[model samples]
Target: MASQKPRILQDTRDMSWSLIPLVLLCLIIAGVASQCSFSPGGPSAGPVPTFDIDAGLEYDAKELGFPIRHPEAPEGWQANSGSRSIITGEEGGDSSTVGFITPAGRYVRFTQSDAGEAELVRFVAGESRTATDTREIDGRDWVVYGEEDAEPLWVADFGDVRILIGGSGDEAELTTFATAVGEAQPLEP
Candidate 1:
């Protein structure tokens, strides 16, 4: 008996293997073209700072001095266990939220607002007074405040910036927590 002959279509399969390189070459060319079109340092570069925030604390806002007192918590704000007593300032004119930070990682935050002003003053003054500036760090715009012997606070214009006032700890821990909180991204405003 004669051996069967191979079909033409069947033979094409073996040669198809060679086409793989051609396909890869096309992909490479496309990738290179796309990359070339991208420009570095273009306008609208997101705001970011030029320094490493994770490093030691720097003084800028620190000169402003520490907050005179912890503002009072807003109405309906519940105090966490071990939370210290908060002093509420005048209502309407100044409006304040009072709360305490315990050394045991307990904090009570009260939010109140009247006459259009929210409970923001206490939030801003509760911690170290830092000089704030708009800066671009890692492709994002942050309102960064520099404090002496304290970590800089980076405020994003996202949601209303909330300041972390107290949680019982040494000076170093407080500084670290403030810095970490500053680096976080707030809700988009």
Candidate 2:
């Protein structure tokens, strides 16, 4: 019985050794799965949203009682999300926001809000002060704000409606988006 102990131990060690490769294979599979990103369609987890910027703009225009502007983005620039946002509380109003993936792979959002002048500047540019510089796009005057090194927030108001163009960009990229929004209007479907 005493001598059987060595034989039993040897059998156990052999069994453990046999399982080592299987364990390593399982670990390898886990590692690969962890690194794998399952973006089924595109940016989102599920099927990527094919945001209809024109349709959203049309709806917002009707709802806001104003012609909400939208961009006719160049090739490779796709709209990721587009919706109308309603401001809550006493300052109740609506805004249209469309998130876009720029051709340069940068994110830029075009927001047209019915907020007050101060609120429009504050909401987009945060605490940043408006720059003295300005630009004209498609016959519309746009006021520029934000640091020189960062993406500047451009604002232009038509009566009670305030249009803000901002997001990841330098002056050039910001200008590009502003131009697109100013020049283009969503055609009827």
Please write out the lDDT profile of model 2 over residues 1-189, one tens digit for every residue.
464556545776788998999998988898788954556677643434568876777777777755566557867778889866665434446777888776666777788887765666665565637566789977889887767666767888766567787788556777777777777664332
- lDDT, candidate 1, 1-189, per-residue tens: 647556554576666786888988987898888853445767563332232211211221122122212222333333332222233444222222333343444343322223112223334446535445555544545444545564444343323223433323444443444444345432211
Candidates' C-alpha lDDT: 0.38, 0.71
User: What is the model-wide C-alpha lDDT for candidate 2?
Assistant: 0.71
Can you tell me which runs of candidate 2 are displaced by over 4 Å?
A: 1-49, 88-92, 148-150, 185-189
Give the best candidate by TM-score.
Answer: 2
